[model samples]
Target: MSFFTEIQTERLRLRKLKHTDWEAISYLRSDPDVNKFVKRASADTQEKALAFIEKIRQATETNSSLYWVITKQGQNQMIGSICLWNFSQDRKKAEVGYDLHPLTQGKGIMNEALKAIINFGFNTLNLNRIEAYTQNNNTASINLLKRNNFKLVIGKQDADNLENAVYELKQP
Candidate 1:
């Protein structure tokens, strides 16, 4: 199965990242609060944003990975992004990541989006395991993973200079 596929949930739609989404995506990625746990991107201009989007498009086209823009049903606004990165050739596992706009925090939007992505990973992609890592201080994310049935495997200091809590869920 193709890794890149649109997924629709009751309250959200996970669609491919498009060129037109750069403007909003740029803003989201540049937000300090939102980018705190994420690796910093050097996208300082529209051209860079477009280039980044194109790279994501190419990655999806090749089925190397998947990056999706999360939007609410009936609205074109991008509330966040859900991604499955570093896919293995064996196709048994992947690293999951997500981020939401600060304005939308505390609304359970991310929790809903994560559920949709995990369901897609296990049911659609037939992946056996999905894993996520969050900084130890990110209680919200840790709790979200726990609520989604991801067991905390352990905590370790990452090369990025943060104590990360690793969580994983295996398909039943």
Candidate 2:
């Protein structure tokens, strides 16, 4: 829990961000299709992507968050990213965020990565809750959460992004 841990599944690997992953990060963060539902600063350039990676590195060092770059089982190129961040003061709760390259969408890749992340959060991190915020119109994300047993957080609002629909999966 103190260091960035790599997660592996049958066909995917989720590892810490690397300097060389800048290209994929840049595309993932800035692509219109990917960002259509996410509202965040763009890291469209390699320089910006590197800066973001550094920030994530610092967060992991401080135990503030864990970010992972998603790749195919035997591939070195990044096709997506996922992280657990925005932890509550008691550390029992944390927000989950993810993105997949458009080409990789609808392939159950994110779902596989998420299952592993959820296990890590509840078991390794011993967290009580994992939250996700998505644009209300993002049916794909909503469905993904549902498939993972995450429930809609009734009456909860995303102060940072009003357009986001809040969902949570309590530790079972």
Candidate 3:
């Protein structure tokens, strides 16, 4: 798969991250609320954001993973990111992660993006299972996963840090 591919939905486009996206990504990552659940080497600097974009580029270049910048069709504004990570060598499983800008919350944009990526994971990538983990406090994420047909197989106490819930969706 190429590093950059445009995925068109009814109202959104999931495209590869670009160097020109730095300004928008920087703003989104800088938001404490937006960065609350994200994990990164450093969340405090532009360099960290650049490094992340580079890492995503490298991952796509190697065909090891896929990440997309969620944008609206006919507009260049970036509202979020959706990614498939931790791909198995046998191509049987992978994990999905996503985040939307605080301003864009409550708009159903993420739900649409999640559906598109899940289809890509199962149909395009031919994965058998896709999973996601979110902090217990992040109800929005958990609900999004649930709405997308991800079952809550594990509970709070089963989490590594007692602060997350793991959800999984198996291909049928």
Candidate 4:
């Protein structure tokens, strides 16, 4: 598909990321509370945020990845973002990633979004396996992976020599 395939869950909708989502995306990518474990370049500036949105859009158009802005059923505001990308050449596997607004933390919104994305990865995308990586201290993320039947896989250390846990869910 030239565009992202939208998905809907019980209480959330996974739609393609739009330029208007830059503000929310910037907040999630820049906030220390949310980016504590996500180690990427600074998206704290408007320029960086615009570039980030373009990156996702290009990835979707090229069928290299799928990124979705997660919103509540009746809400126009994005509470978070979820994606399945970093595809293996054969497209049998992909890596999943996500981030949520700090204000929405402790709610089940992400859990709901992830479930739908995982389903899309396995079913529509016909992927054989889906994987995720989270720092050891990210208990919430690790638990979410496990709840979705992803098993912990051994991994190597990062450039900083810090270890991150890898989780994988295989199609049954």
Q: Rank the candidates by lDDT, best first.
A: 2, 4, 1, 3
Q: lDDT per model, in order?
A: 0.85, 0.93, 0.82, 0.86
Which digits, one per residue and each the tens of the lDDT, describe model 1 over residues 141-165?
9899999999988544456646677
TM-score of every prediction relative to native: 0.91, 0.97, 0.90, 0.94
Higher-scoring candidate on lDDT, 2 or 3: 2
- Indicate the worst ten consecutive residues by lDDT in candidate 4: 154-163
lDDT of 1: 0.85
lDDT (Cα, tens digit) per residue for candidate 4, span 89-157: 999999999998888877898888988988888888899999888888999999899988999876534
- Among these predictions, the greatest lDDT belongs to 2
Prediction 1 TM-score vs. true: 0.91
* RMSD each, Å: 1.8, 1.0, 2.2, 1.6
RMSD of 3: 2.2
Error of 4 at 170 (Å): 0.5
List pairs with backbone clashes in candidate 1: none
Which candidate, 3 or 4, has the higher TM-score? 4
Residue 35 local lDDT, model 1: 73
Considering only N, C-alpha and C atoms within 3 Å, which residue pairs clash in candidate 2? Answer: none
lDDT for each residue of candidate 3 in 51-166, tens digit (9 for 90 to 100)? 77898899998878888999998888888998898888897898898888888999999999999988888888888999887877898998899898998865424334456677
